[model samples]
Target: MSLRNITEHTIALKDFQVQGDAIKTHPLSIGASTNRTVNGQQNPVIHIRPGETQLWRLANIGANIYYKLHLPGTRFHVIAQDGVPVGRAYAEDTLLIPAAARFDVLVQGGAPGTTRLETLPYNTGPAGNQFPRADLATVVTSGTPVTRAALPTDLGPYENLSHATIADRKIVVFTENKAGTIFYINGRTYDSSRTDFVSTLGTVEEWTVRNDSDEDHSFHLHTNHFQLMSTNGKAHDPTHGVYDTVNVPKRGAIVVRIHFRDFTGRTVYHCHILNHEDMGMMAVLDIVPPGARPRATHSG
Candidate 1:
């Protein structure tokens, strides 16, 4: 995407740049960059057999873009989220992807033709950043059909935290400062000396996160994946599965249950928006074993 905007416009062949003095506030354009050369247009091609079922791994690896993927001729059987397999597959025509999120999907190829992987425009809010829609990539199917089987419904040996007793509890609130420029989590910013919350290893914790800000924000943790228990005071479908990161709607709340298992270290949770994190919407999380005691407590 061309954020190196207006000042560099004359250098490029096409008028692919957004025209404005508010370069920092304008939406970004899309472009595909590779190891050798950066293509202002998407020239990447994916080949597939007409009748084969392919596993498509979709990731919003971009730092700021939110891609809502749409494939007109295909249906995505979402099998995983953030590399963790879901309990069951979900069939959807479009999938919303925030920054730092991922989805593993199974797709049965349609008739021999080209399919465009496109991103529709998304409005986070008047206060949140808005990104223009753009085509991400293209997939072409050729050759004769191949034998295909139905999507497997089973995701093996996944932990069910719903039945687990909650050993700890926390409420994370996201809000903005009075000047409306910076973001705050739990009324504070990132301070390594100040850990926001400490979770013990081998325990289950239920957390409620509320977004008091005017813009949409996403909550992402480093180590453990969490299950969505509720959103805005309603329980989500059990089959919706787990996520490593989740979108916290403006002025709304989300409840998730997490199991700290087999790992003990310091990690962090922050808004996936890169600028937001740099602006103090991040905090440290220390996970210690049940008996260990050698660190600071949550100050925020």
Candidate 2:
């Protein structure tokens, strides 16, 4: 199910030019594709046979805001993340989904009853907006029961970067002005003509990304996915797989390892919050062929 947040107020052309903080206060109407109702309206329902397992491909395609999804009394057997199959499946009662992230999971129908698929209250940070709880859809299991399908123990092999030799290491810092009107990476607003980072193809590099602002930022990269190594000095499980977008906590840091393979060209790394990107929390990244000299001057 694709999830998105719609604005309750009329979106004007000037809205697109607003700063990130100003955009945060806009009223949101969050809903799923199958059932797009808002504000106390009856939610669309899905009927399932009890004990039957179904694979649900969920994607958060919204531009801003986060979804802390919960389906009480059931667990989601997550098999994939961001469309990439994980090394192994894991179960969780609540799934914290950021914008642009996707997860494929196996959900088994519970006893005959109606339950609401809802998002819990999520407070990003003191400088961020607080999203209230809302129901996305309803799941009703009332048909004849069926045998439950066995969950997969393993999905497939994933890139394990634990023992790989790192070619280089870089640091990225996220910051913003006190007014939150303009955002920056490494203290510079995004300049399309400027190449902020340059790397070589066929190389693995580690990056330590720090967020110095008071709000959370979702860091996203183009071209290549990255495996999270640690968050705030805490190591992550190798099986967590790779993702193109990950959250960087306010005033905290995260470590990620990226393998620049195959493709080489100019792309970008940015804060996934749409308004933040519009306001300047982005930088250019150019990946050149191995042994090829970089064409443009870079900040780092």
Candidate 3:
């Protein structure tokens, strides 16, 4: 299942301005798709036998919205995130997914009845928009009851970067103008001609990402995944696994350690919110070969 925002009238991101950290046009509706139908138009259903388990891949593919998904009387056994398998499956009653995030979960069918998978109201912050509750899909279990399947064990191993030798550390800050028309990272707008950060391949580096603005920002990096070390000065369970995107709360900070593995090239790190990205909350990163000097470019 994927969730997205739908406006009453189509509006381009370039034309949609921000005021006080809120968009000029709030989404008229939040659309959910099991396959093709939107807003449960056809009442899309997931048919399963009672007590049987099925794997469900849920994703937040929207540009700027967040989904706090909930299925009453059901617990989601999360096994993976962003397509990467976790160290072990963990149960969650609600999932708070920001834009571009994905969660793969195992769901066991309940009694022979129908239930709605819905998103609960989520308030990003004082400066952000409040998203209301919306139903995403209908899950129907009608077949004869079956033996409950056991949740999977032996999920692949995950790397823990807590004690890794960090080659370097960087600080990334998210900020925005008072009017909220423009956004920034590290105090500057994105300049395509400039390279903001450079790192050597095969090195592990830690980054402290701070959100200075009044709203939340989903920090996302390209080319490699990162292990979240801590958020708001609180340590995170390394066993939760790595992710390509994470939420940076308003005026709070998160520390992530990343291993610059195999691929070497230029990529970007930015706010996953498309509007903020389009408004300039992004930076360029270049991974050069070890012992090689980085190419000259305008500094951000």
TM-score of each: 0.82, 0.86, 0.86
Per-residue lDDT of 7 in model 3: 10
lDDT winner, 1 or 3: 3
Scored against the true structure, residue 23 in model 1 reaches a CA lDDT of 23
| Location of the lowest summed lDDT over 10 successive residues in candidate 2 | 6-15
Per-residue lDDT tens digits for candidate 1, residues 9-113, read: 100001133344432333432222211101334436667777777777777665655667787788888888888888777898898877788888877777899
How far is 292's C-alpha from truth in model 2 (Å)? 1.0
Across 155-220, the per-residue lDDT of candidate 3 in tens digits comes to 878899999999999999999998777899999999988999999999999999999999888999
Q: State the local distance difference test value for candidate 2.
A: 0.78
Q: Whole-model Cα lDDT per candidate?
A: 0.73, 0.78, 0.79
Scored by Cα lDDT, where does model 3 land? 0.79
TM-score winner, 1 or 2? 2
Model 3 worst lDDT run, 10 consecutive residues: 6-15
> Candidate 2 residues 120-209, lDDT tens each?
888878877777787777889888887777778687888999889999999999999987778999989999888988899999999999
Q: By how many angstroms RMSD does model 3 differ from the true structure?
A: 7.4
RMSD of 1: 8.7
What ranges in model 2 sit over 4 Å off?
Answer: 1-42, 298-300
